[model samples]
Target: MSETTTAESAERRVRRRQSRRELIVLAAVEVFREMGLEKATLEAVGERVGLSKASLYYYVRSKEELLGHVVVHVVRAQEEALARVLDAGGPEERLRAFCHSHVRIICTDPVGRVSAQVALSGIRDDVVRRPLHEYMSRLESILRDGVAAGVFRDMDLRIAQHSIIATLNAVPLWFSPEGRLSLDEVAAQVSGLLVDGMLAKR
Candidate 1:
């Protein structure tokens, strides 16, 4: 084959490999969510995806690695989504968008919800802490900006940031698609509750 054709063929192979890995991660997320990260086993994940335990290692080094992929995927998505909203609006608007996005990610999206549900305690600290800290910092920055803009009341910024994050992070634990409130309604309600409280009174 010509060099160009060879490169194209190699690229296709890489894409196919990545697609398979993603499929494995999705199956692993379901198992982790149902069984709890500490209780989940590679064999269970392998069975979910129709791979033998040995075959599963071709895609992931271990159960911890698979969990790492799952969490990182969701975290990266949240980061990207937040990045888009950060520059698009003033602090209030950005905070609203952030709240909505958090709910949508952790409640509306199944994989994202599963990712959120997985306890970070089972994963390595470095694997879990960096992205989480970054996300927390992003939230803090928005709150700081809002306060500086005179749109938000002066309060304990750290407490406000943690409260907002904890509330949204708990969505995957109790939120139900079959519940009376649609995801959009939950998102709006959450945004209102958190954002309205912080608004400076006239």
Candidate 2:
């Protein structure tokens, strides 16, 4: 085969492999959510995906690594969404969008729900901490911008940031697609509660 054709074939193979890996990760998320992280095993995840335990090892080295992959995938999506909001809007708009996006993320995806439900202790410290810190930093920057713009009241940045995140992170624990509130309703409620609380009283 010509070199170009060979490269195209190799790319197709790589894409197929990545697609398989993503399926494995999705199955792992379901297993992790159904069985708590402590109780979740590679064998259980493999069974969910119809792979033997040994075959599953081809995709992920260990349960911890799988957890890291799941967390990273979820966080990376949030980061990308946050970046778009950050780039286009003023502080107050950005803050509202951020809150709304977060709620949507947690409520809309099984993997995202798994992220909130599962403990991150299984993942390497830096792997878990770095994305969290970066996301929090983005949040703090928006808060600070609002304060500077006199749109938000002066307050402890750390407390405000943590409070907003803590509240949003708790959504997966209680939110239900079958519940009375829809995803957009919950997002609006959450954004209003947190964002309105920060607004400077007229």
**What are the per-residue Cα lDDT tens digits for candidate 1 across 52-106?**
9778888887776776677678777788888887788888999999998988887
Worst 10 residues of 1 by lDDT: 119-128
Clashing pairs in 2: none
Q: What is the C-alpha lDDT of each candidate?
A: 0.81, 0.82
Error of 1 at 88 (Å): 4.5
**Least accurate 10 contiguous residues by lDDT in model 2:** 116-125
Tens-place lDDT digits, model 2, residues 133-191 = 77788889999999999999999999999899878878777778799998899889989
Candidate 2 Cα deviation (angstroms), residue 88: 5.0
C-alpha TM-scores of all predictions: 0.80, 0.80
